[model samples]
Target: MSYQLTHPSLQHDRRILLSITKWLLIVGVSQAVQIRLSASERKRLRKIARGHRSPVREKLRAQIVGDAARGLPNTVIAHRCGVVEDTVRKWRGRFAADRLEGLKDLPRSGRPPSFTPVQVVEVKALACQIPADADVPLARWSCPELARHVVAAGVVESISTSTLRRWLTADAIKPWQYRSWIFPRDPDFAAKAGRVLDLYAGIWEGESLGVDEYVISSDEKTSIQARCRCHPSLPPGTARMMRINHDYERGGVLAYLAAYDIEGARVFGRCEPSTGIEPFMALVEQVMTQEPYVSAKRVFWVVDNGSSHRGKKAIERLTKRFSNAVMVHTPVHASWLNQIEIYFSVVQRKVVTPNDFTDLAEVEDRLLTFENRYNATARPFRWKFTRNDLDDLLTRIDRHQAAEPALTEAA
Candidate 1:
């Protein structure tokens, strides 16, 4: 979009004009200055001149023109307007020459752009490309580096980094910043994800779930390392954070498998030696053998594409073991859809952050004890993402994927 730039100095020009009035008076020579206006034009000028919100320069110009039309001399109008005599004469001459349009500021030719149109376009386009593509040994583009490359590529004879910066900033082009993204690889991504989302929202397959039914999000946090700090960790004191030594002795690693009830907010988990079908089935037995799950109307188990519980076999296995249990697998690489990950994140931040465990036994105790303490006060995660949000996200992904080839070609 193109917009006209206004001169700000004109807003306060009356003050400047008044300040230099004495100098102009000493050197001022009188000239016959007269202007004639139609009755409507005179009314318009009077309205602009008396308006409180009129531009200062415009108000002064209107007042000068009105006085001149009243047969006043240049000096008298100048003094009345608090401007130099030459200022009055200039407006009077302009009004006679071009009427009201003459009162507006003429278009200004701003400082000419340093680079040619093609050079600027090429520079911005170059910013969109990988630096390595041009045989330049760079992972990203900085202003000075881009300027150097643009010159070397014969797009421009010479360019300053600041000039290049200004051009890129105008177009909001920043080559120094980057982000990582991936296309969804699961063929049944939306359908599978929507099913899990529906369970969280208390609707299973378009039907409201009964009070006795339950949705469980299960996941395994593997390789939780017990790194014993060489020196003991200090407790946080006033104005100081708790510190952990970087150097550490490798105590051991263990897997924490968890199943989080979405509605009831209860977490049933155990510290296992490793993750597999047998360990996972053991966890299922632990949860299903309990009072409510054993007698509930139905229990939906939400898990990811892990070997422990995957494919139709895992679903059949769960159903065979417990008639009430139903297995729901999240789409491949979509473990984030599982609410158990949220509980795992809390464990990571609160318990395993410093990782100052003495041994694998201490790790197991901490994990199991924290689980009990957590379930005492835990509330179900407030999952807000729904089918509508998923649809919007998929729409955006579709648009991005559709544009990728064109973007690649442009690059």
Candidate 2:
């Protein structure tokens, strides 16, 4: 029997076949959207994908492109890389459109800066100056105070302290903090300080020191008080810190004299009721009477300008007592350069801090015991600062001083 062309059953069947074909074409096109990288592109992508230091986003993009180039389907690429299917598809399409440049983040639009550049410069300049120079009563500039002052001075119409703080933080400027420093007032600072630095480096008079010659850094830690706590100290336990009593009884005070061998890492310390010419002389005797030092070709004693050992008279005395001992004094107010001060700081932190001694005798015993303990493992300090560093520092200081006149004139 011949079928009619306009039959309802045939027409319905035709519509169904057309719809199936359309859906199949769509699926084929979607799956055919694949990435094909060139030789150079492939090398770059592989390098980025394998790099441990590549940026996270760049690495992800590179990995996506790499997998896509390997004929991975979008779903498989997403699954393997722990990313969403949409993300994989998006990056794949972007690479196909613009190659590697399309993987970078586009410039974002955010809020404009609240303060103008001029206002920022003014604020920073004020921060660089002392509060006294500005005739303000504040000793230093807090963020809030600085903001208010800038507004009052018409630098900015208005500003928030938090915003000001953010600006200062970006430039690493903190005006509210103070660091203690002193200028080199002694005229012979360079000559004297250079000599000490040279000694630490095993150099003297432009020649390497002899093997038998020794360098010693000596200093006195005075007024160490013994504090007997009213309540017993609590030892640390699970999830608790060691408790030390705030109230303490003053047992007594004493002075500690220590001498450190800059080259050998040896320490000799003595506890005395007080520090003076007499006590310091005894410490010298204790060290000078020992081996190696006793028969050494030369022993350079680096000391600070303390009253106990100061001036030509003290040098004369030390040299007269031990002919091999050469007294070398650090520049005035420059005790921080002394290596013995470093040992004293260690003693303060480890032995004297949070002091809970029962009596003066306990304090002395602890200090002496720690000296021996330190010497057992002690090594010479790695003194890196040399004459070159000193010269550079002084040059910078001179330049800063020379600029003051111009800065004042401009103001």
The best candidate by TM-score is 2
Instruction: Identify the runs in model 2 with alpha carbons over 4 angstroms from their true place.
Output: 1-32, 35-92, 97-104, 406-411
Q: Give the TM-score of candidate 2.
A: 0.79
TM-score of each: 0.66, 0.79
- Model 1, global lDDT: 0.90
Worst 10 residues of 1 by lDDT: 1-10
Model 1: per-residue Cα lDDT over 112-203, one tens digit each: 97667888889899998899988899999999999988898899999888888999999999999998766679999999999999999989
Candidate 2: tens digits of C-alpha lDDT, residues 1-411 = 677869888999999999999898679557745788899999998889889999988999999988888887777888998999889988988888889998887788878977788889899999878888898898999998899998898999998988889889999999999899887888999999999999988899899999999999999999999999999999999999989999999999999999999888999999999999999999999999999999999999999999999999999999999999999999999998899999899999999988899999999999999988999999988888899999998998899999999988997
**RMSD from true fold, candidate 2:** 6.2
Scored by CA lDDT, what does every candidate get? 0.90, 0.92
Best by lDDT: 2
